[model samples]
Target: MAYRHPDRETIKRILEETDTIAVVGLSDKPDRTSHMVSAAMQAKGYRIVPVNPNADTILGEKCYKSLKDIPFPVDLVNVFRRSEYCADVAREAAEIGAKTLWLQLGIVSEEAAEIAEAAGMNVIMDRCIKVEDSILLPEGKTNR
Candidate 1:
């Protein structure tokens, strides 16, 4: 069967519930999209955990080399990596017990979706988390 992303309501709920997001492939450079999105989310009251082997920190948060390296609970695994890398990220997200696997805009992987789904994760592919948050919770996470 074909892959199916969650609806608007579910996406909104996921955004509302998520407190910490582990961002895979996050870049330290401010000009990068990953950095921009993560920064925006952080500004909106979400904890942005940077996952990058190269960076020691991003957006003032400690950066872990990989998802398995994060010592605390991550509510969502927000991937900025390419499509080919997502399946591995899904497994790591599952291993770390995250509730959601979110592949950023223009990135998607059926294998990644399958792996996350099998582990009972809410999968969101080819979508930007920052954009969704802006549209759904326009007021920011002020109520949270």
Candidate 2:
């Protein structure tokens, strides 16, 4: 079978420990998936850094032109781009010493996953962090 990314326990640990997330391809449009997901993460007490080549701001956070432009350490690099673009972003994420590379739902690239894993970074592909977080929340806790 293909490499099953970290087991459930490991994934939970990573999610619990990760505090800051850099959302690549983030857009200012409220209707965009990236925007909505980032907003949800922020609501859950995670610091969200917006990364977009064309945006100046998103969710009140300064929008970085690229992953390399972010001045601080990013615990997680949440990719919101097309599959073809993920490998490049994964390269940058690895170079920047990010702890994890999370490819948003529907955005999957084996090459990207391999690159990040080779760099000793955790990788999650074809999944939505927001949805995962919601699913993992306590029984009565609101995901909103």
Name the best candidate (by TM-score).
1
Kindly list the per-residue Cα lDDT of model 2 for residues 48-126, writing each as its tens digit: 9999878888899998998899999999999989999999999999989999999988888889988998999998988
Residue 3 CA error for candidate 2 (Å)? Answer: 3.6
TM-score for all models, in order of appearance: 0.97, 0.92
Model 1, 27-47: lDDT tens digits are 999999999999999999999
List the candidate 2 regions with Cα displacement exceeding 4 Å.
139-144
Worst 10 residues of 1 by lDDT: 135-144
CA lDDT, every model vs. true structure: 0.95, 0.87
Checking candidate 1 for backbone clashes, the offending pairs are: none
RMSD of 2: 3.1
- Candidate 1, residue 77: how far the Cα is off, in Å: 0.6
